[model samples]
Target: MPAVKVRKEEAERAKRLLKRLGLYDGRRRPKREGEWVLLPAVGGDAIGTLGYEVLPLELPLRPERQLYKNLESILAERLSEDELKHLRRYDVIGDVAVIQIPPELEHRVDDIVWGLRRVHPFLRVIARKGFHEGKFRIRDYSIIWGEERLNTVHRENGVEIAVDLSKAFFNPRMKGERYRLAQLVKDGERVLIPFAGVLPYALVIARYRRVKITAVELNRDAYELGLENVRRNERKLRGEIEFIHGDAFKVLPELPGHDRVISPTPRGVDALALTLPKAERWLHYYDFVHEDEIAAFRRRITEECRRLGRECEVRVKKVSDFKPHVFKVCADVKLG
Candidate 1:
């Protein structure tokens, strides 16, 4: 394997360029040696022309789950093209694999289970996922195979989080988004996070940045799990966390302003008017919006900022797809 050696500051830019030219190796994890980062790349004629030193070194492969299409590859021979199109992506939390079996593929549940088990040989449970229910947003899950429990210790972004699908909410797909936010956060900044389920965002940020984070959650189970998670990663974290079990609507009003306010707002709940006022510098507000309404969403946030008498700049980024033509977006609001 050929790897390029570039300064840490230029690593991201080089990786992007390599990816654009189809030379970056997505399967291998980059290794950092002090000021330089070793980026894995495919052997090519262009490798020597990239200016950076290219060395033949074996880099460690990323986790199998991050590859994302292994299960689909295993099932390609077992299922037809029409059935394959209905195959949705699944999440592997710790040792449990949770997937939604659509009506079209419900008859092939056994094959799906076999594929998942083959892909993740250490998997202890394979669950059929259901819609999120109640105010806590905990999903309804049925253990179709292996262990009869929904509890597992999920590891992501350098932290361990204990989650119980029957009790609380956790999304493993947000790992990259969480890391992006963590990198944006500065050391010593006072941060506030509302609807902090199991403290995923807080833990990841604190693991890298030395800051004081105050996270609030309304659900008792989530709050308890979040406290446990803090203890689980206390030694690894560089910052401090103060977890409060309370409703953000009532609690944030009594609290003082922070350098940054992150509202992982629940679906259908409008916390813009509630959270934007508490941010002294930056506000990362998450919401679901139709593609057509993204401009309207930006206007709404701008209007709220104006109403609050704060001069603001709002940049909306599509985080993920929620449904057809609908996306989960984050409005990064910077205030003066």
Candidate 2:
């Protein structure tokens, strides 16, 4: 096995950097020798790219630890060590625990749910069947324990959002990104969030800034929930947020222009030209790209702006990784 050796003091920072670069291998524990920490790498090529010393060593395979406490304790007797490694990670939305059960462990779902409930008594467990599909970007989930409902109120950065997991798409991992975006909003500016699922972006921004926000959603259920969320946090908000229930492309052209536009949908950047109120507007566009394709992705955006006859100054930021070698990225475009 190949590993990167770093000073013990720099180990934690190096770990985060490697993970962000999609080069960290979590299956093996790091070895410590004197002042150096040996971190496992996914491949040999990462050493040159990361500027680290690569050390080849013989190490034994260890059982990957489970995030949920009782899952390992309960399944230890019933399943082999290899079977336990399949349980990677799960997401928690309010009182609900959303997990993806591997196809090989389909028959043991009942036991898995039981163990999860034992760890978090108040949590309602749901199993995600597959990747988010269709135009709506919603995933299929089956209730495995506790409540049968999918509706829950999630609190993020002093904002409360009512979301139906089956009807709308909301990623709790984006809490930091939402807060950062809200902080960038100037007072008394107009903002727009297209594909505003359950109004998470709108609510968070409105709670912090005095800007007026227009949120557009196509799904009827998500639109209704967005309305409820607006009322739920009306007293705490410092700004006005209007919930519009219609296709973003159809509704954007009809609404007034905004100083800043947030196209939160990864696939919605092309529609931004239609929503621009005038030249010199700030555009925050989200998209997914391969680790090695960021430069090409920005080039595409630059070409799109040229095709639309809008001059753009663009900057790219990596928000998070969706899977191995694939990242969720944001392009901050200043169009004039």
TM-score of each: 0.82, 0.77
C-alpha lDDT values of all predictions: 0.93, 0.79
Once fitted onto the true fold, the runs of candidate 2 whose alpha carbons sit more than 4 angstroms away are 1-78, 266-272, 275-279, 308-310
Clashing pairs in 1: none
| Tens digit per residue, CA lDDT, model 2, 89-119 | 6677877878888977778887777777776
Candidate 1 residues 63-165, lDDT tens each?
Answer: 6535446777889979998998899879899999999999999899999999998988999999999998888889999999997899899999999999988
Least well predicted 10-residue stretch by lDDT in candidate 2? 58-67
lDDT of candidate model 2 versus the reference: 0.79
